[model samples]
Target: MSKKINEKIQSIIKQCESLSNDDIESLPNYKKFKVFYSKKSHKTCDIYLLCAFIFGLLAIFTTSISYIGIEHVLYYSYDRIFSINIYHEECLAPKLETLIDIFRPITSCDICQHIDHIERISNITREEFEEKYAYTNHPVIITDAMNDWLALENFNYEFFKRIYRTNSSALRGVEDNCQFFPYKNKDEFETLGDVFNMDFDRAHMIDDDYKPWYVGWSNCDYSTAYLLRQYYSRPYFLPERSESSKLDWIFMGTPGFGAHMHIDNVDLPSWQAQVRGRKQWTLRPAPECFHICKELTFIVEPGEIIILNTNVWYHKTSVVSEDEISITIGSEFD
Candidate 1:
């Protein structure tokens, strides 16, 4: 408060600075003085406990999930997550049949044992498909099932990006309400969202040094599905009494990249409509029947829809041409 006090403080500091380290340490005050510490507070512990409890609940919380012939579907219905009015009844159809089919065991080994080639057919009626191929292990590529569909002429990379741009189910190709498979592009792209975000040249592979990407994801958005359904309808060959899941699965990418060899655990057989480019399907028998069955490869051209029980077949796919990007849309029917 006073000049005298300031002088006294400076003198004490000078004396302390002048003292040797050993002298300062030897002081009685330094030796007897204690470092005061209050008891550890429970506030920090409470905060950590609260955070752990929250995380535990979040871990148990899950999104809607059911098999729809896609690799695996983490798909939920529109009504569960959004306030939008329902439009498609297939979206709300009971998954109990799918669940039952998933657990049902295949009793016959004769199906795969005698299979050697994928049958190609055309102008087949519902009775024909049901009698010959629907319940059989023979994979078939129907040549005319997609002939009347507009998807053959208009479905492409750009068209897909435009329709799904506002889709909440698969926003940016992330798993908002659905699942996405990057396939071979997993190293470079984590999701369909990443592939769509790339530059024009790289995305279409317009240059020599471009990177190739192949991806697949389920279409769960009701509005987007409605737009897609306009371009295509049920295959004429599917049994008239069969049930169709409203969900659609899409695979799109440049040539030289596609899905690797893998077996699916879906509830039923699926069909893939080749809308733009040629794709080769290589089917291998399941491990149990490998000794008796052989691997078969078939090329599906544009406007062709291939129906195979992917659940029992280990399959691999490759783009068949460099001239066009491969685009396919498919769904499961029971």
Candidate 2:
């Protein structure tokens, strides 16, 4: 971090310390601050103390309870006694984007021109991929690999509705489990039926200026995972070490809307298989790699898969086809 950025963060911390709870809650960015604070509370003093006490007492009887279980308990206990908004730093960081613009070098990477295209392969062993691309931060597109996937034939809006709508055990409308991105509003749908009922094409046909909508979710629920696994399996190029089955994610949307520019937080590289329609991805290296790496823009068509170190690259996606809906299944791997 730059000195100016550090000073700005410090100034925000000082201002936050002097603010009362009501004052903090009144800020325009309070909702974002609340989410950030909730994520951070697990690392604070109170959680550490509770974990220490619980683990200490458990040690007297049996070591049955794992550290992972204790960590989850800490995560669930979001109530904090301290009134100060520790997450005020995030609220202020967005505001400093313009002021800290001078810290980045203006020089563009010339190598980008030479590397205009991502590597495309039809058959590659898992060992080859791990050695050449996995940790080295190179991106590759694998073709002819997902030809046998049932997802290519069965996954659609109707399939999702059938699996989730009538079943009482189906998971729906959980903000952390499922998300709906409306073209105009931040409000999400309440159920899977709501998503399936959205007439994206008819809406655009009726109104010339209508924007598209998107729906995305991870297989965080057992029922959802069980249904989805019937259609798709793990990509073959992925090493055995990858926990791809455990962290699967699915994205569904009409052309014109997809994920915005952002970096993912993951311990391993990720791969996304385009099951239907098409998507254009724009990937840029992190600020540290800006000088050495060129920004890449590429299209991923149906039946194709792309693997990249998303944790190191800032990326965004857009639907490329005007009429077709895009459905992508992806997962993180070690």
Candidate 3:
């Protein structure tokens, strides 16, 4: 873009143009090689032809250059080389990172110097949990926290099917009010509607020949959320001052399929209750702290709950095996 570079580009463009007869005659070899391209009879026509050829090539060049404007989504993994696209921006103001540093001095690089692993605990009082881990950016799993929830016994594939079928409003709310992540299986199930309308056996997941699918969606309706909450209660360990999210989420899938690694941009920390089957969670630190922190991986068995500050911890999940569908339900609490 400098003047020197612009001049060089113009010079290269001029060199590709056909030379005039007067210009060609100045060369010493003009008499020896009277190029047919320079014949007097076809001189004007050939110039036009050359112009057309150059314009055609330029058209292709411009088209390719314009294509770079399209948005691209990328994915990354810890300890694995993959493309990454982190898009955190504000519409009309500075980025969240800049705005954060404006108010609070960010010296959090040392936040994880002591956080070696996500702890596992049970029967913890709210005060104890808040003193140790609540909003602390440290992750932990409460092993027996969900023991009283009836969701463990009732939240299976058939229960979901029945609820959605009988409660048309809830089904409609899921489609219209929530975002559905079809993950890599968007080819077959473009919408949650299609997922529910599948054949009976496939819906029940009764056969081995069924196609693999993983999906996640939030319950958007108050009625639907209340219905689903009938089986589960707010985690007792949440701090008294903590605020719970209005939206609740469910992620279900077959073995070997789960969420991609990504950081969330949300107001509250999240807690996921592993309801039906076992799931493996892999948590990674922010890119800047990749070396300063360690990547932690663990399993959440049924009746256990895992909580983390997902706004900071890059996390992903996977069903443990082909034996059962992975089911998890949770909401965020600030």
Q: TM-scores across all candidates? A: 0.66, 0.61, 0.69
Model 2 Cα shift for residue 276 (angstroms): 0.5
Find the candidate with the highest TM-score and give its number: 3
lDDT of 2: 0.69
lDDT of 1 by residue, 240-290 (tens): 899878889999988888898866767888889999888988998766676
Candidate 3 worst ten-residue window by lDDT: 73-82
Query: Which candidate achieves the best lDDT against the true structure?
Result: 3
lDDT of each: 0.75, 0.69, 0.77
Expressed as tens digits, the lDDT of each residue in 133-248 for candidate 2 is 66666788999779889999998766766665543355452333543333222244444456655665643334656557666766566766767778887788777685664656
Residue 139 in candidate 1 has what lDDT?
Answer: 87
User: Which wins on lDDT, candidate 2 or candidate 3?
Assistant: 3
Q: Give the per-residue lDDT of model 3 (tens digit) for 69-186.
A: 3232122221123212223211223234434434442336565657777788998999999988886777899998887899988998778877777449888787766767777765
TM-score attained by model 3: 0.69
Per-residue error for 227 in candidate 3, Å, reads: 0.9
RMSD of candidate 1 to the truth, in angstroms, is 16.2
Model 3, runs deviating above 4 Å: 1-107
Candidate 1 off by > 4 Å: 1-107, 166-174
Task: State candidate 2's TM-score.
Answer: 0.61
Which of 1 and 2 is the better model by TM-score? 1
